[model samples]
Target: MSAQSPIVDLPCALIGFNDLVALLHALFIKHGTSPEVAAILAHNCASAERDGAHSHGIFRIPGYLSTLASGWVNGHAVPRVTDVASGFLRVDACNGFAQPALEAARALLVDKARSAGIALLAIHNSHHFAALWPDVEPFAEEGLVALSVVNSMTCVVPHGADRPLFGTNPIAFAAPRADGPPIVFDLATSAIAHGDVQIAARNGERLPPGMGVDSLGQPTQDPRAVLEGGALLPFGGHKGSALSMMVELLAAALTGGNFSFEFNWADHPGARTPWTGQLLIVIDPSKTAGQSFAERSQELVRQMHAAGLRRLPGDRRHRTRAKSLEAGIEIDAKALQQLRELAGE
Candidate 1:
């Protein structure tokens, strides 16, 4: 059995995003991360928590700090960007975090897409520790379509078989809208996210039916089984499995980085960075088909509402973001305590 979490019975607390970011920044800096890198990490962590993405929030700090302390990731490394082709932008993260690498590539990516109709960025040598949406949301807001994918440490199994092979490999996509904010969605190809399994185990809850299999490769709904030694299944069997494969190749093979299995082997077991990879592609809709891009996408949204489907993938996140901005975000009491200790408070 896995060890129980220290905060299983601790009370939860409400904290504003600013305060949380400050705490996280302090903790990262204390652990040897450069100020600039720490700031980028802190901002992303705060945004994840504020948007109700609990899995990638401050909860990720311990793992990140572990990597920093052990030298698996270079907190002071700088990402280098080069336009390798007419529409290809390559970003080398130099073994640092993904946030800054993505940030550095953003403006150039947008400009390239606007001029070439579409642009692709291959990012490697980074430790990606958050959701993929944050990387695409900005491009969408700037009136471009954005799609991104990343490969992580394998914790999921390929379809029709068991025993780990793929990470919860996630893909994120976003596009501009005629009205309201852009439409966006980020999802793991797995039936259940690895982080969700960890959270479920921490909460002492049962996994949903058909979520995954036990260590023995038998279908099981026990979170502990999945987390301890089992593997999560693809979201839609063969289809999800295919997409997972696509993500692994796009984020790893094309980007010239370690595959999930390679990352798993390269690490020293606990408290280490995953040394993941990501690929980002941006498309300028107006450049592609003029104003019709927005018009057609709006028509599609209208059709969805006309069919009585009330909301879309990122709607809940916007709502939660609103609430977080007004009332402050909440953090698990135990996580907050641990973060304080990391900061030597």
Candidate 2:
């Protein structure tokens, strides 16, 4: 852990990537997840930790385990992929986690895009509990333009509305870069992600300005209020609200999955699968921009790097990943304790 970071009574543990994955695998297996599915989820968690996204890494294990324990997610799901139309493929997640389903379709989807210029993969009845960049970064690494979107359980209020109507719908985009790693970026339409608010609450931390509103529709920076009987605020006001709506249409409507509001919170308050869907598009820029695609991309990136005033997207993540892969992952003490209990260690 960095010395600059705040220290607590309990010191965090530095766990090797291999050990972390093994721990998650054991926990998932204990929760009745098949080895293959467990590995996929483990890999996703490890990747998130490697990239310094702790919110989606070990922080999410308990929630995933609870859902699996509830028998709401099919641990052995192998996700069926089928052809829909020209350059369009559909994947049925069988009420399973999203990673395995997307992984199963990667090779075929990439090949289709390479041959057809663009390919769309619509994932239905899946639960996306991880970061979106992990889904698209690999595609970008292969010199493809990747775009992914997913909607979750509703928590964000619509623009100019007091009640919650949308999820913290997330969108991720990536473009290949010859000079460096892919230009990967992912973000939720809400001013703050629901997971982030929960994380803050877990750590007993306050939230930043304009992140959410209290139960009475009043703006507040308290994470507790934002999570309990309150709603998150859409980022950029109307713009983020519109983009959140777009995600609902693209990921939910287009993919034939449940919308955020479709979740019946009153019926099942316990942990369960997100029952969400995702849309991913991969495009071979080579087909559209011809031979100059790489050169053009390099030129723009080179200019930006030369200026030194702005940092490229994904650069920080790449740096963090390198450090993590070399040293290890720094896990919070509480999260480590939970992992130990979950693994029955």
**Model 1 residue 10 lDDT score:** 60
* Whole-model alpha-carbon lDDT for candidate 1: 0.84
Error of 2 at 117 (Å): 0.5
What are the Cα lDDT values of the candidates?
A: 0.84, 0.85
Off by over 4 Å in 1: 1-10, 264-269, 290-292
**Per-residue lDDT value at 268 in model 2:** 43
How does each model score on TM-score?
Answer: 0.93, 0.93
Pull out the clashing pairs in model 1.
none
CA RMSD of all predictions: 2.2, 3.4
Q: lDDT per residue, candidate 2, 1-345, as tens digits?
A: 211233355777788888888988888888888999989899888889878987787767767876776666788888999887769999999888888889888899998999999999999888888888999998878889999999998889989886998989999999887777888899999999887887787677999999999999899999989888999989999999999999999999999889988855344444545788999999999886455565677788888879984778888888888898888888778658767787898
Backbone clashes, candidate 1 = 0
Query: Could you tell me how far off, in angstroms, the CA of residue 227 lies in candidate 1 after the best superposition?
Result: 1.5
Write down the worst ten-residue block by lDDT for model 1: 1-10
